[model samples]
Target: MSTPNRVYLARLAGVAVFDPNGDQVGRVRDAVARMRATQRPPEVVGLVAEMPMRRRIFLSINRITSIDPDGVVLGSGTLNLRRFEKRPNELLVLQELLDRRVQLDSGHAGSVVDVAMECSRGGEWALSRVAVREHTGRLTRRGHLHQVDWDRVHGLGAVGDNRGTANLLAVLEDMRPADLANALQDLPDARRNEVAAALDDERLADVLSELPEHDQVEILAALDRQRAADVLEEMEPDDAADLLNELPPPEQDVLLDLMEPDEADPVRQLLRYASGTAGSVMTSEPVILPPDATVAEALARIREPQLSPAVAAQVFVTRAPLTTPTGRYLGMVHFQRLLREPPADLLGGIVVNDIDPLRTSTPLPEITRRMATYDMVSMPVVDRNNRLVGAVTVDDVLDHSLPRDWRDRDAVSPSSATHDGILDGDDE
Candidate 1:
């Protein structure tokens, strides 16, 4: 490869990645480096590129024809579609290192601004330079910028209480909640908490739901009681209930008490049901409308950007009260059916109640069987009084059915792993 002797990894973020034929494949997300046992600088692994559909895959540095500020050209088009998972001893350059608090060999406190990787004469790449900005301790003036050898920096190998997250969060701002969660799982525990803590309540709530249960519990615990309650309030009630279920009753109650009465009420109700039942896994906030609502109104409600695809796939129609515990559950209408109906038509005239709704106490196995038989993405759950209470989506069923710790499944050790991840890119 013909490239500059040194490349700043942070600047490469969002640079387009292309096939040899000049077709765009993805954009640079971050650089991966394998930490060394000795004082030697970490060896540069490859670039994590965000492909079409927000799928991130690894591209070996060896496959690159050239590298610059513009774009990365890949020698091969064949690519692995498997999701990228981080292995121990592997550091994500932008996510884990940037905005890190560090001290210079001269003992000046500063924070990492960027990192540069240099190519060796033998063709191997390694992180070799550090760009840091000194803490001016003055609000009127910006800090002094320093570009020094990687070895001249201290505190880069560990987390500090004063680390800044504004730069790191900026790089992650455009990512989807699930993608951001994957990136967070790759960070050191303390760094992960620091970054997660920096996100606003709504963003953190979205990311927390995507994270593994243990990670969710850990990040939530890292926050103060009031802030934790606020984040939980922003999450979907079912997700908030699911996360709270992981904590002991006393801890759960404390956070619940801190949440607003309206938000806490639905979650408290969800918590009342036994695990493995419909009520326990259903989302209390799925798209809901009254029977007298028009097709256009139902369409508009489903179009709300905050609604999950599964939740928005259909609209549950009921009588009177539109919220959970709504009066007289009246069935539902799929968005597809809505598209076929006149905008002025009332939902009550064409609702599909053919499939029976799951009762709160119904077992998950039965629910899954029925959903599969009916090809439904989501199914309504009601109370004995025939009032709409919640809706169980396919994702909820899968979450409960998967083995605990599935998110932490084993990956090939860093020592043995080839290009792309635990598995070789070619094989995957």
Candidate 2:
């Protein structure tokens, strides 16, 4: 067989560094690239050592002669260096990162357990986020932690550097609402609810909307009426409607009554549509711009703070008259299409008229068929009068279609076929 490809130094950053004899030589720290005179790839340059005071040592990429699942073997018998340099402003050491807190963002937190490096990113390297395991109680219980890519990490800070007495909850509390929501998904139900209750109305709303339907129900059921109402008010109308539809009729009515009229009205309107129909599933929160508006103007409108959070996808351009009580139905303007075209292009010119709008009364199966045929992720819902009602996302359809028989699998007899003889013999 031909010689295998030699793994580069940059790819070996987080790889377990070992001596030629297979003795562990600490993990590869960070890969450093030095600019070269020619346009060729940067030299393997140096390695930020994971051990011996987290020192930085220079090593040639050619030094890494082999790689295996177990560890890496250096071409040289041992890594020898005359001198090493300390990374300027480097506060974290590999030992410290092993069990220390790294703030993913202001609201999200996790303990660093291991760093992973992508061997394929040429010479580039990245830090991988891993959940820290902690022991508790007299029994010395341990729990699993989540792993997230470092790219998703918005910020990083050190927590509990001294010892194993870190407060995970306090660190998690500092993360942003969005990041916190993501982090909480990995928490236990009781702990998740506790964290949800601890957040303010806005943060609670974010977390609730981000949650899976079952978890959302649990959190909402646990919240007081006022808090539930506040969260519902903050949610997109379609999302609010879907959430309310899951609740008991009495509980739903109570929460609806507590919400502001403006906030509750859209949800009520959405509820009038059939459960899987476009109107019932559509979000009333789309960014609607007049047909006459230029791309620049539409962009400006999108940038405005007053726009709903639901408008992140696209700006729906309707005939100015259509926005009124008697306005007629018009086409749509997707954000991607808008960005690709010239800025001077009129919103009307860029409107995609081929999109098929769905009626509130349309059957869900038919809607699903159309979605599959068109490969559309979301479709607008309208009423008999062509009034924009709500939007249905592909995810909503998939969620609805997912079989509820998940628990039924456990009820099945594992040996049903083989047990038939036993049953018959017993009857005899």
Return the TM-score for candidate 2, rounded to 2 decimals.
Answer: 0.52
Best by lDDT: 1
lDDT of 1 by residue, 77-132 (tens): 46655666667798888887888898899888888889999999999999999999
Q: Model 2 off-target regions past 4 Å? A: 1-170, 173-190, 301-311, 320-326, 403-428
Tens-digit lDDT string for candidate 2 (1-428): 01133332323435576666777665554444433454433333335444332323444444565554455566543354323333333322332344455555434554555444333335332233344443334355554455565544432332333333233334444544544554455444665676677777766776666556677898898888898999899877777887898888898889999999888877887777666666666667666777787888777776777444445456666654544222555767766777788888898888886877887777778879998998776677666777665556676666566553211212222321211111223210
State which candidate has the highest TM-score: 1
TM-score versus the correct structure, for each prediction: 0.83, 0.52
Clashes of each: 0, 10
Query: Model-by-model lDDT, in order?
Result: 0.87, 0.57
Q: What is the lDDT of residue 216 in candidate 2?
A: 80
